[model samples]
Target: MRSTGMRARSVPHDSRPVHARPRETEYRPRHPLDLARVVLPQRHGAGDPTMAAANGVIWRASRTPDGPATLALRAGAGGHVRAAAWGPGAEWALDQLPALCGADDDPTGFDAGAHPLVAEAHRRHPDLRIGRTDLVFDALVSAIIEQKVTGMQAFGAWRRIVAWYGERAPGPTPKPMFAPPTIEGWRRVPSWAWHRAGLEPPQSRTIVEAARRGDAIVRAAASAPDADGRERIFTSLRGVGVWTSAETRIRAFGDPDAVSVGDYHLAHHVGFVLTGSRVDDDGMLELLAPWAGQRQRVIRLLYASGIQEPRRGPRMHPEDHRDR
Candidate 1:
C-alpha cells in the first residue's frame, strides 16, 4: 500500500546515529516495474552482505535526507525507497546501494556467449544477478589481514579490527556496522596490537609496509587499465604474491577471471568439485584450462553448485595473541 504520510527513520550500513529523511512512505514503484532477477554462482569466500538472503532486496534504514546515515533500497526499476529506517552511517550504506546491487558487471566481457558456465548457471537459476562489488577499500584491508595466516586467524583479526574501529549500522536492526580502517588508522596499529590479533611478524610487517605505501598502491590501481593491471601493480609490492594479489583483486575490482591460484583451500576445493579428487595448484589450473579467461567464473559456478569439500581432519583453532 502506497502511503503519502509523514514518517521518520534511520539508515543502514553507516555506524553513526540516525536522523530523519523523506521517503516514498509506501511500497510503490515510481513507475510500473517488474523485479530484476539474475543468476549467481555459489562459491566459498564470495559472500556479500547485500546478497545475503537474510537481508532481502529491500533494505530500510533511517538517518538524514541528504546523504542520510540511513536509507531504504528497493530492488527493480525506478527503485523507490519505502519509509525511513534510522541510524548512523546510513549515508555510507546508501551511497553504496547501487554497487551493492552489482551494477558494474561488464556484460560484453562476461556474457553467456563466451562463458558457457555463466550461461548454464543462468539457465539453472534465472533469478541470480551477477553484480560487481566496490572492492577498492575492503580488498586492501582483507589482503593485509590475510597475509600468511590460517583462515580462522585472519577472520579473527578482521573481526577485532571492525569491532574496535567500526561504527554501528544505521538500520532498524542493530547490526555491527564497520567503516574500513582509514589509511591513517592502518598506520597507527602498533606491533603489539598485531600480535594480539594472532598475526605473526611476517603478516604484520607486510601489512605495515603496505599501509606505508598504501597511497601509491591505490593510485596505481586507480590509474590502471583493468583489474588485471591493478593486480600486477599491487603484486609489485614486497610480500604480495600471486595469491594475495588475486585475492585482493577478487574483492576490489570484482574481476570475474581472477582465480585465486595460490590459496591453500581453493585448489583442493576446485579439485574435489571438478574431478572428485584433491589436487595441487598445477592440477587445479590444468583442470580449469578449458575455462581460460573465465577461470574465476568457473570456480564460482563449481562452488555455487553446492559441492562441499570432504573433510579428513580437524579444523584450525583460533589463537589470541592478545593473551600473550
Candidate 2:
C-alpha cells in the first residue's frame, strides 16, 4: 500500500487560482516482480544515472496490467510521472525491454557488423525498455495533435485536452492522468474549438476523419505486422502519412521497427551521426541500408545511446495557428 501527504503552495505562472496538493507515495513493486529492475534507465537525458528527468509532457503517471505499475518514466518530487504509461496490451513492454534498451538489438542490417557504433550502444544500455501504451485511442489522439505542429505546441494542446476531458488514474499517481478521448468527445469538438487547439484545417480534418473511423484504424493497426503495416494502413487515409503513422506505432504498439520517413530533421540527424555530415533521403537510406527491416530499432538504439549531431541551424519556430 502507498501513502499520501498534502501541502499548499502559491504559483505565479498558473493564472487560474487553485489550491495545491503535494502528494507522495511509497511504491513497492511486489518483490520478484521488481519494477526498478525492469525499469530501463533513461538514455536520452542529461542527469544523474539514478533519476530520469522530464522529457516534456510525454511523461505522465500511468498504470499497467500488473497492479499499479509505473510506465516508461520516473516519479517526481510531488509524485508526478516523468513519462507516459504503456498499458497492459502485451508482454512486449517488459519482455522486449532488452532490445529497446539496445541490449538485444541486431543492427547488422544497418551495417556489415563492421560498424562499431551500434555495437557500442548495446553494450552501454542493456536494460532499456520500450514504452508500450496499448491504448489506441490515446496514441491516435496524440498523433493527430502532432500532425503539423511543433512538439511544444502539440504537448500543450494535449495537456489542455486531458485536463479538460480526461480522468485521474486510480492509484497513488501524482500528476493528473487521463483516459483517451471517446468518439463522442472527439465528434463534439467544433471547428472554432479546433482553432483554439492550435491546429490547422488539414490536421483537424485528419483527426475528424480518423475519429469517425477510429475503431477500424485501431483494429487494423493492432492486428498488423509491425510499424510498416501500421504505416501502410494509416497512409490509406486521406490525411495520415508516413511520419504520423510511424510516430503513432512507436508508442502505440511499441513496434521496434517503425522509422519516421520524411521527417524534417531525422534524415539530417542520421546523416551526421553515420557519415559525419547532413544527408538527404538517399544518404539516410544508404546509412540505414543494413537495417532496412529493423531501421526503427537502429534509430531507437541511436537515440538511447545519446549520440547527437551538433546544432547549427535555426530552430523551427512554433506556429500558433490559433492566432491566424
Candidate 3:
C-alpha cells in the first residue's frame, strides 16, 4: 500500500554532556566559500525533505555509506564552514564536508577573458565554484524525477516520495527533514506508491532499475579516470541520456564541462546572452566551442550575468498522473 505520509515522531535530543557531546566539526577552505550557492541548488523543492536552509545555516539529510545521517552547515568568520552531524553516519558526513562544500574545486586554467559577458560575470561573482556531493545515487534519482516534466510537477512528486518513504533526520533542525531512501529502499517502492506520488511509468521504472544496480554504478563513477568516463557510466543505464548524465555529473562530480545540451531553455539562454539572439543547441555549442573544457562554467557565468531570454508562449503546465 502507498503511504500518504510519514508517522514517525521527531527524535528527542540527547542531554548527556560527553557521550552526548554534539557531533560537530569545522572546515576552513583556501578558496572563498558561498554556503547558499554550494547547498541550495541541490534542494529539489521548498519543502524538500532532504534539505533546509534558514538563518544562514543549511541542513541536509542523507543515507551515507555508513548509515543514515543529518548534517548542518553554517558559514563562519574567515571563509570557514561550521558543520554538525547526527545519527550513525555522522562521522562519514563530517569527513566528506570539505568536498561537499567545494574545497577540491580548482578554477585554474579557466580564462574568463574569453568573452566580455563572462568576464563581467566573473568579476561580479569570482567565488562561484561547482560543489560536489559524493553521493551519486541521490543526484541520479533527483535528476530522473525531473525528466521531461515541468518543474512544479517534478518537485511535487519528489517531495511526496521523500515524505512517504524517507527517514526523519536526527538533531534539532529549524524544519523537519528526512534522509533519502537507500538503494534497497527505492527498489522496494511499489508502482501504486509511485502513482500516488504523481510519477509516471517511465521515470519510476528508470529509478527502480537504476537502484537495482546502484552499487555498481557508484563504483564505476568513483573509479572513472575523467569526466567523460564517469558520464559514460551514467549514460549506459536504461532511460538515462546525455542531459540526465550531465545533470548528475554536475551535482555528484562537479564536472565543469558537462553542459545540458538537450535542455529546453539552456540553448536559448546561452544564445541570447552571447549573441543577442536565440540559438538552437547546435548553434549554442558552436558559439561555446572556444571554451571546450569549461562549457558549463560559461553557462553559469551567463546566468550570473543576469541576462535572460524574453519569455514567450505559455509556461509548461504541471501534469497530474494520479487521476489517470
Candidate 4:
C-alpha cells in the first residue's frame, strides 16, 4: 500500500548544498568509455543507498578521508565525464574523479588473443576498465559483510546498515541517499544495530576489530608494494580471507589481477564461459593463469559478454532472520 503522506519538496539536480558551491571538474578520457559500466560496478547492489542513477547522471555519497562527500558524474560528448562534488571533502573527491572513472587501470598487456569470446568481448567494449573508490576501510567493511553469504543477504544488510548509520548526503540528490559511516562510526555500530541489519556476528565483529586499527590498515594497504602486500594486510584480520581481500582490492585499489578466489559463482562462471564446463577455484585459477596480470579483466570481459552458465537446479533462497 502506498503512503498518502505528503512528499518532501523536490530538490533540483546537484543544487549547491547550503555550505558552499559544488567543486566541479570535467575529465577527458584518452580511450573510449561508458560511464555506467565503469561507475555502477562500484555499487554494492541495485538499491545501494550510497549510489543512484537517473536521467543519465550518476550520484554517489561517500566518506572521504577529509569528510563525507557527495559526487555527481555524467558522461558527455567525446568520452568526457563532467563531475560535481559537495561537502568538506568535495575537493578530495573531485581530485579522485579520474581514478574513480577507470583512469588508473592499465590494460596494456591484457591479451584477449587466447579466446575468441575474450577477443570479441574486448573488441566490443574497449572502454571496459576497472574502477576504484580509493576508500580502503569502507570497501573492506562492505566486503566483510558479503563474506560467505548470498547476494540477497549481503546487499540487504548493506542497505539497512548504511541507511541507518550513515550521514545524509549533501547536494541535490534525486533520491534520499547517505554516505557510509566514518571509520570510528563503524567501530561504534552497536551489536543490536548489526543484528537488525541482518549482518552475522562474525562479520560485525570483524568490522569492529578492523575499525579499531582502521588508520593503520588503510596506511599499510596504501603503502604496500602490490596486490600481494594488500592481500597480506587484509587477510591478517581474523575474519577476512582471500575472497574478502580480493573484493576489497577490486573496490579500493582496482587491482586488475585481484580475483575473488572463493566467490560462490565466479569459478563456475569463468570455467563455464571459457571451457564449457563449471570448474572449482583451483581450475579457475589455472584457466586464468595464462593472463595472470589481467585475469580479473578477463573475468569482467566474460561478464560483459553476457553469457551465463545454465542453471541446473532451483535457486538458493536465502534465509532472512531479521525481525519484521
- The backbone clash count of each candidate, in order, is 37, 9, 0, 0
- Candidate 1 ranges beyond 4 A from true positions: 1-95, 107-122, 127-130, 168-173, 316-324
lDDT of each: 0.54, 0.53, 0.82, 0.87
Among all candidates shown, the one with the greatest TM-score: 4
Off by over 4 Å in 3: 1-21, 318-324
What range of 10 consecutive residues in model 1 has the weakest lDDT sum? 38-47
Between 3 and 4, whose lDDT is larger?
4
TM-score of each: 0.70, 0.66, 0.90, 0.92
The residue-by-residue lDDT of candidate 1 on 79-193, one tens digit each, is 5433343444444454544433444444345444334444576456533324333445456666666755676667777655544444343454434333345555566676766
lDDT by residue (236-270, candidate 4, tens digit) is 98888888999999999999998888777888899
Q: Poorest 10 consecutive residues of model 3 by lDDT?
A: 9-18
Quote the lDDT for 235 in model 1.
Answer: 76
Better of 1 and 4 by lDDT: 4
| Winner by TM-score between candidate 4 and candidate 1 | 4
At residue 258, give the lDDT of candidate 3: 86
Positional deviation of 4 in candidate 2, in angstroms? 36
**What is candidate 4's TM-score against the reference?**
0.92
Candidate 2 steric clashes: 9
